[model samples]
Target: MLKPVELDLSELGELAQVIPGPEPKLELSLSPIPQFGAERPRIIPVCEPSLTGNELKYVTDCIESNWISSAGHYIQAFERAFAAACQVRYGISCCSGTIALHLALAVLGLQPGDEVIIPTFTMIATAYAVTYTGARPVLVDSERETWNMDLDQVEARITPRTRAIIPVHTYGHPVDMDRLNALAERHGLWVIEDAAEAHGALYKGRPTGSLGDAAAFSFYANKIITTGEGGMLVTDNEELARLAWTLRDHAFSSERHFWHKFIGYSYRMTNLQAAVGLAQVEQMANFVAARRANAAYYTELLKDIPGLVTPPQAEWATSVYWMYGILVQDEFGLTRDELRRRLAQRGIETRTFFIPMHLQPIYYEMFKGERYPVAEDFCRRGLYLPSASSLTRQEIERVVDTLRDVRR
Candidate 1:
């Protein structure tokens, strides 16, 4: 039973104005892609990249300059820009968010049998990254308030082997970083932010990436700021950044071209991707603003709906609302899946929340009989609405209207 946070009506009204023109129709003809014929029903996507920026021009430059591989100027430019946005000094660009997490942990020197604490409610990438370093990911249930790792339970799981704690800002809501940092410091543990979905989020006015020892961000097609398929590790630690940059490109020793000092990876982001990333970075502020505005309006419209729990933004956190999620309570008369199916029938796309790590088939046997009540509860009830930054007010209204119609 998570209590909803109070929505700031004044702020909501102010931000809602940022949304551009009228609401878009729920339908989108699928004629553009040759795969889907024009007959395909127009569906409002759950998430989509807004590429109205200089993505094309930057990409064309990369191609013309013959620097489209991983070694172009755009890569460094994108990295620096994104790092600055996080208020950090360094950014190590990588091929994907999971790789960024792995690189961060690797630089921290995680060893086999070491344990890293993480929320069971997060995407599997967090756990997988820890596993990549041969370190075990110790699971913690989520707190109801922020739907983030329960800091209260974290201490109980810390043991001699616990070396780090990866705090995931669930659904773009910043976790209580100060509290988590204090707890980690007391235990002599490193704090790594799993900020893959929380671009531009703030915790007590500080950017999320700068709050931890190191943070990972995803630039996937559906993320707040996309590079099509890329990620970055932002940090203030020079040594960590240096090591990650080296390791991401096969750890080729600088002393000699062919010599290798450490086992490394081919986790490099191409300049082509960085081109798009820089374009996206240039528009990150607007993207974040749009997401916050959309979340505010969605909350306002959905607040009156029975059994629907809109996402929460803690007083100290300014959530980017990466995906505008809602929890379906038992009183809703319809199960979460039922609501999703009905939404789909109306040509609206939706996505279910992440299933906890303990419930994942790959990790099931390892965590057999382990019950993280809060994470499991979220999995059963949570679903995201259309949450793209490109969403117009009319589009949001339509989505809300569909929810109301289905509930009836």
Candidate 2:
């Protein structure tokens, strides 16, 4: 469930006293579509962090306490808090989302040559993490509408060696976790949700991270919430949680310090990062609301533009609009690359969708002769506009106008 931010103005008399009152506004030429002989306004960045909360305060506390390493009150507090936020029993904070996936895979005990199914449209980290565990990643195409993995390929990709499926929640819109989990259960396979993009997003009233057997989340600066650079693995199974905890560190036995058993990597988030993460987690509800509002405004302004398919919101999903992507049809005149260039020339930053993994040169021999047409098409046409949570109503209008004016 998305908890919308509710301000109580009556109780903030002290805050209200310090806030400057509204003043007369000046009219400047700021339309995305410039008037004849007028100059367009300056650039708009694609994303920015909204860190107006206790980030500094909590981090300062860690420094003052002299416990700024991975071990501190803040670390455990953040794990518990984030676990609760995801509606899971445990959240093992790690170094990055990639490492989180690595830990989850390691905990699953996937040996060399074991295949893990993943969507080719996701960030390379998803596939790389599987490779880190000595497991082979089987690529699947994305759905045309949602740009998520086409579930129909799951069965085709799975075999006796197929051990797990990693369904990444792309653009803050969750994959059908319930259905994915049902499929996993049928094959006795594990489901590791790559929920790096779906923080605060819900599917059928359940949080994305909680729906999968174990989920990995990224706290990269551009994510819905940030901890500078951190990641977490949340799970309902205590054994999985325990194993991930050890795997994140040096795989030392918890029974004795400096006692090593299995191979492990150093993937620990410091107390300082956790301090920042805790603060961000507290503001999650409000941050998601702001992103959703910004996306809604963009939709409202762009709906009338021909040949532009807006970010999808499925009947069973509540998207947080993490990147606010849109598909540019050929009828729009400019190709996606050309549009991106034009948008950049107009001082509006944009990002194209990830190149399909199947098309990447690194996998040429492994996936040769295989074709995933839908993923190819979406990768060419899909691009994300400026989706900063701090985007203003006027900014959204300007972006839409600039897009509307694109031509051959």
Candidate 3:
């Protein structure tokens, strides 16, 4: 049996200032049970993929051709098309976004006892990918401006053991990649962009997947593009691309039938998944446009709400706004969770921000005394509204109206 790690309160410092006190007991019901005679509103999910393209056509072709497994024309087509969208030379399709990250790290040849810097305020998979390589993940707090890894703190965190840096473009907002890349170059480190949430986000006119040594994107149902479930790693590095393609399929030696050159993973994406992915990628531009337009509408409506902080977009970034997240300040008159509860009761779904690596139970012991003030604040006050690309103006208004009603 394992015991909990003892938290060091003194290390928390300013993080303690934003703790939001003790959490009240949560209502078990996500939404109120509909009254006997009441008509309940339809549930608006937090995110849903917009698949109004040739998804069915491609999938039907896959079935008719009997190319449903990993080896099929759709696999290469999806990889090529998506890579072109990123302005990259190659794309390696994989089972999930998590596997894409792992594949990229494995291609970089990260070894145990090495270290990789990552944003503490990102999806847990970013950290998990580094851990998968037996490399230690060094965390840095996020910057308030872009809600991205603070580049200033990155330099201080770098050490002789640092082999790479994985900067996530949090919530579709591109990070300050120019600075991050320069810093990594100065330190002689590899840079991998964890671009799972940023399908078409741009930094200085370049797409997210083209901004680093290599990048990964998720095709989960909730993402801008969906293949039911899949991911891809894109890059301009030919060697890295070839290595990843081989490793993703278990690294079978080309010279011999069953001989293995290196330990690899069975992370291949099926042709059926690739067929859907190709169709999704075909409508990538339209999906990105819809997401941006929806985000603009959400910002326009929510901007004047007191204590509500709409997501930020730096001057150099064109965020796809994957999920329209906002911070609820004390002036909102309701805690973030309370607001989420009220919205739930009205059949509107919302999701809280990432709970930071330091606060995660699986990582608690390793980062027990670590503290990231900004990440803590975000976890406390942040929650994303329904931001599906398919969301309509009426739905957005309803969600916002529910938010206003909660304050009232």
**By how many angstroms RMSD does model 2 differ from the true structure?**
12.9
TM per prediction: 0.90, 0.90, 0.92
Q: After superposition, how far is residue 320 of candidate 3 from its true place, in Å?
A: 0.4
lDDT of 3 by residue, 273-378 (tens): 9999999988999989999999999999898899999999899999999999999999989988888877776678788888888876678778877888889889
Model 1: how far residue 19 lies from native, Å: 35
Over the stretch 84-201, how does candidate 2's per-residue lDDT look in tens digits?
A: 9999999999989998999999999998989999998888899989988889999888887677899988878889999999998889998977777888999999999999988999
| Local lDDT at 393 for model 3 | 88
Q: What lDDT does each candidate get?
A: 0.88, 0.84, 0.89
Error of 2 at 367 (Å): 1.0
lDDT of 3 at 192: 94
lDDT of 1: 0.88
Error of 1 at 193 (Å): 0.4
